[model samples]
Target: IYLPYTGTTIGSFGYVPMEQMEGGKAYAASDLYSLGTTCFHLLTNVHPWDLWKKQGYRWVNSWRKHLKQPVSEQLWWIMDRLLPESYQHRYQSVDQVLEVLEFQSATPANPSQSTSKYHESFLNFLTSLRQNDQLKKQVMMGGVSLLSLGLITQGYGYFRYQTFPSNLSFLIAGLPSSTYLKTTLNGHTNSVRSIAVSPDSQYLVSGSNDHTVKIWDLPKGELVRTLNGHDGNVYSVAITPDGETIASGGDDNTIKIWNLKTGELKNNLTGHQGFISSVAISSDGKTLVSGSYDHTIKVWDLPTGKLKQTLTGETNWVSSVVISPDGKTLVSGNGGNTIRIWDLDTGNLKKTLTGHRDSVVSLIISPDGKTLFSSSLDRNIKIWDLTIGELKNTLTGHIYYVHSLAISPDGKTLVSGSANNTIKVWNVETGELKNTLTGHTNWVSSLAISPDGKTLVSGSRDDSIKLWKLP
Candidate 1:
């Protein structure tokens, strides 16, 4: 038995068992449970607390699906035995587990060896048969005879199918090539300034310079509805994490929230004194942040549409704003070529990073919240270390201003839309250009990657949205 004292500090409470949570005595099985939880966390990159909150130990199924490599059934059984909620059901002694492992290890070599031998003998027989001329000729004649019969049968079936309707199977194989233009969505009458895909990837939303926000069915590229509330050119749009609400900001100096499902106006938040340039929603969908030409950032309560806090210190127009995945930090790009990191809870400026030679037009943080990518009017994108506030690397290839940027869900690929009428894809790890996509007749205004990372969507100033199939 083990007793956890009052002052004992655990590195991660997620690894602790339920008995420890109740501040009661624990047995050796509790320690085994903690060990198993640690193993799961290390293997699947998921926390035990999150798993418990979501579905208790049933999260093992989810973790197993996410494994990078397969594990033996014996190993899975052992892990499951260790994670039982009841101590009485878990392995009572370490010696018992070791004995089971030892027995498994000692019992498994001969079957695979015998299977390998059988396969080798079968292959040798086929080779020998191929080398024998007489046998080969006989086999070829037999195969030809069978094929002729099959062709005759297939012809009969084809004629029969012509008279009676039936379904047929067509073997179409091969994935999409490296990068190809999939389709062009045409509805926005003016320049499409911003684009966002819903969390489920079923709907796409676009804000255009024609003073309209349009929603389209993602799979068919058909216009679903047109929202006509913004009185001026709509510049920025964001979908809530839940995919139920959309927040859009534009030249009207107001942020409008719309019901994503019904396309009805939910609320109109007004506070900015100038044109709103960018808008972003927290990962939890509880807070909405907007940046405007008034040189201020406003954080609002998403549920009630009430102003929560206002942050003002930038000297020029605030062009872009993005929240970290953890929902604790906010990064903003301003027209003065500076990036500011702010404490989301306190609304205080934490650090100011400077490197761009011209206006910072776009900002995006990595999915891990460790690195930040920013695009500038200087025709370059800079990678920054968010923790230490240092410039890590600079990517240069665009001949004109870089207007928009997006990162893949896996954080391996970074895509940028530029004023040069091209989209560039880069390897995030090595800062190498992977591919340059060209189709837009004018500047590329916005870019977004679908949740599956297999589709890249670009909205260009040519008044069109193009979808690209990614490798």
Candidate 2:
């Protein structure tokens, strides 16, 4: 479980400062201690305490021989740092610890080689020490001889270290244009702010600032149904994956759930106090998340317009919200330039990511729920390490504010729309700029990709949405 102020310790026993340990006043190293102990448990299915009995407690020993799984050396180093008996010897900061874990070591050691290296080094050093008394002269000669050999070995190793190969990691390649098709539906008087394609891709639903939501017959680009209810601008819209119901939230501080077949409003969720900024329906279709300028995010039951939970504490307006594909976690972005993660079952704040410089306008979680993509008025998109809530990298290319973002179904490509009237696609793994779609005449307001990951649709301030065939 995630703790509040109590820091995480990393050792056989979760040792927090005696004072802070109570009511959970733990140090960050406490997490490290837990990690090390957990590592030991995962490796042997035996608790660290069971390995060695200590004073009314169990301590883990045989630190070198026990852990046999495929783990990075840097992580082992961190585990050691955390399990130190004295806090002074433990990792002082998370950054320092992460640096070691992230440091690209020159070689990927095989388990046998790693074990041999450790044992050989230890034996060599011990042998040299055993001969220390008899002949001080021999000791001096041995020291000089070993020093010269060590320098030569290091110099050669530095110059001959193997260069690791780089390989392209693409999740979804754009479909070849010769075999692809395109279609565009024209109806709304203003720019479309959000679009949701039915699971079968036969129907497309769009909401616009024109205060109307329209459903279009896909592949033919023909208007099918128009649902009108909002009194103000409609900023966002989402359709259930089953293609049965539609949910739209707007500047009116209300969310309306529509029956797709009958074009009837089933329920109007009206608890938000300010403009509705974004909305998302969980994969299970039972929960709906709505974020608003009121600085709170509300989780509601779709079938009954009842409030399930209210997530508050954002210092500024909550601009966007998304639930992971699994529906177990909720992520919300705010004008305070922060991203807060919540546990859906317990309705508790899990983490607060504070790295963005300007208002965070949009957020998209990866399909595997391992990473989060956030766009902000700061003119950059940030990829975050979700598990630890660390900023992995900042992608820069947009000359203006980034408005909307979408990740390809394969998760390798990230497409973002910007106020510069361009949609840029990026290689998410390498942070490389792939291509820029520049057909729009004004600022691009929103973006969407076909389920097959070939066609890209972008809504722009020019009051038109264009279809771009990926190259």
Candidate 3:
């Protein structure tokens, strides 16, 4: 039995301590020891093997000194019981650990009472672990039953007294609310063309025809800063996954990168001859892809702003660009009513997907990078199989041209903004229209989903941005 880290695997058994490996027999206490090591590593920001090589079990005794937060005596006692070098001295059963945790919960040992920041940070770390599919599968297969229970208890203890955003409740699998408009942000002097949200969900950036980019405090809908650098109408905007940089493309035929926190210009990329229309950053945040009226897509080195590759096979103006999560494939929608898939490593065309009767206006790849969603001026949204390059389904609900599309973080729901002044939410797998959001009085030009999958932001030609509480 073992506790898997980010890069650990079952085949990598040499990582086990020498004493545990020599026995060739795993006990319940062995599992507890491994979990305790994992907890110590996470708390101290050091690898277990490094500490074991230097100081053996003595590393556990000094772990508290390395922690960023103060640990309570009850918690320290629990940790001590789990890290004993002798199996007889360690925890013998899952029930024993739970009993300790339950008793600790009743006392003032709760981390939230003394160090709320530490508890919040630890909660975020556990939430990320739960979201990791590979780690979850490995733990289930390894049969580490107690670790699962411990994670659940920790989650409950942290979240029980904390208040989350109202829309967060709707992110649950079966909990659907009556969708409603939450607030309207009115700062763009002209039609808002594009929008992007930071990965932390704390800030929103919007590009407008007024030739400026505005950053807003997401929850409060208050304007934070106005960026005025573009000489032409800003057409597209994107935020890096790290939430440190902002990229925008405009009719000035240039791509500008800015420091998101400081609002300072970082780099200016120039190559496109026509108006830039769409921009997307790879999941790794190393590559930036942009599409323009020049009928081409250009890939750039994000840090240096140097051109890496230019794709120029499209016959019409490129309207949308998206990169697969793996950063191996690039997908672009063109005014020629087609979608093209390119191999990022080789800069070669892989396939052309054709189904829309009119120009393809927006494109988004599913979270798993298996399905491609495209919206078109044909008034329809087409779902395509990324592996086989075939159309799987077509959703027809919008009365006018569909302008933009966004998928939830879980890839379970899709929202499309249309020229008919309405936004439609659909079940991605079933192609069923779940709800129709009607608030924008003019054409909805852009759409973005928050990283938490709870809030949906839409920008319109009506010169306003609306935040929708998703169901």
Candidate 4:
């Protein structure tokens, strides 16, 4: 009888008596049904019966049915519990529903508890706004009232501290010194084909020939989760800026997105004519870029799995692709011994970078986009003045083909993995050999640097991924 317009029925927490109440027991199924009704109302901004009138609710009749975008699995699961049909099949107790909502467990607050305090104060402020004119007046007057001055001042201080600066001033300074740190992750069963560090450097993602991507928590050195879907060797993996989703490309000719935390496969994006050799995610994580042996680079709408555009022309395989830190530029290397830069927004070819005598295997761009580094089968890594598309310097020392390359976060150290089974670190400023890391028993296929510029990771054909500490 107490159904308010706010989408919740306070009196019918879970049910109503068949006689006295409008409904029966407030079981899990009944709760689920109510939830579905409530959700439909929230989504369409109309009443549940209104959707039924137009048959729009038919699309949401089952839990398995796919709905429109923006609904997360967690939310979907909650809706199912809230709108079940059968009272017996529905959650019998609030505890059951609470379990699904992850409210079954409780823990003490943190030592500081400032976040808790802030949240409590926020709720009080919101409630007071309705009845306490003193608070409302304070808000209307730019939060300047004697009655609320202290709370307002504290809230303002908290808000100011919580507002992160536009950029970390330290990151703008360029790559930190190469001081190698070691990491240990255990999960992959076969040769690791690729490794990509998260932008924040907190998570490390690796794709393996074993047909899985292993996500690892860094610094602490623990396996977080394994992403499984690809049928063939996983060649590349890229984590979006938000760190909630992971995009992986592989020999399966498909790219799959995974929920990083839940380790669930979101969707399979398929269209490549051949094995996808490389993948990169835009800064916003809304678009995905991939290259394949099919001799094409494709951009995709990450949310809808739609192909945005395809760049074609390579007579040979496209090996590696890197989206510049700014997300506006894309650089791709191909078996044709050339690299091309594209304006991602317009899908227009910006410049063709050429000079390598052999197939270009890998490419990386400095944070500032001022320098481009590429490794090629010609046993050399070349630096380019990206502003003018001119070769700045050719770094040579590897006795065998260079297969993978990575630049330090500061752009001062460049490291390359080679078929010679060695990882070479170089001085970007002087083009001098800094260190030769030897440990791999087979061809080194992929390399990555930690965000702190303190660790280097290399994947080899011997079915092992090793970590090298930089000095």
Per-residue lDDT over 1-471 for candidate 1, one digit per residue giving the tens place of the 0 to 100 score: 122334343435566666566655455556566656766665567778886786654454235555565543334445655675545445554434434433333333444433443333433434444456675444333322321232223322222222211111111113322348888999988889999999888889999988999999888889999999998779999999889999999988999999999999999999899779999999999999999888899999999999999998998778899999999999999877899999999999999999997779899999899999999866799999998899999998775569999999999999998765678888999998877887786779899998877688999877899988864
TM-score of each: 0.63, 0.61, 0.63, 0.61
Q: Model 3 Cα displacement at 18 (Å)?
A: 77
lDDT of 4 by residue, 1-471 (tens): 222222333443222212113432233333335544544444445555443446432323332333333443334334543453323223443334433322211223344543556535644544455457665444333311332343333333333233211122222122333234354355676668898777677888889978889888776778888877888779898888887888899877899999887889999988888778899988778889999978899999998889999988666778899888788888999877899988998889889988997678899999787899999866789999987899989997775568898888888888888765667778999998877766565667899887777677788765676766754
* Candidate 3, run of 10 with poorest lDDT: 163-172
> RMSD, each candidate, Å?
26.8, 20.4, 24.8, 24.2
How many angstroms is residue 436 displaced in model 1 relative to the true structure, after the best TM-score fit?
A: 0.4
- What is the Å distance of residue 275 in model 1 from its true position? 0.5
lDDT (CA) per prediction: 0.76, 0.67, 0.77, 0.67
**What's the lDDT of the predicted structure labeled candidate 1?**
0.76
Whole-structure CA lDDT of model 3: 0.77
List the candidate 3 regions with Cα displacement exceeding 4 Å. Answer: 1-179
Which consecutive 10 residues in model 2 have the weakest lDDT in total?
A: 162-171
Candidate 3 Cα RMSD (Å): 24.8
Give the Å shift of residue 54 in candidate 1. Answer: 58
The TM-score, computed over Cα atoms with residue i paired to residue i, of candidate 2 is 0.61
* lDDT value, residue 323 of candidate 2: 93
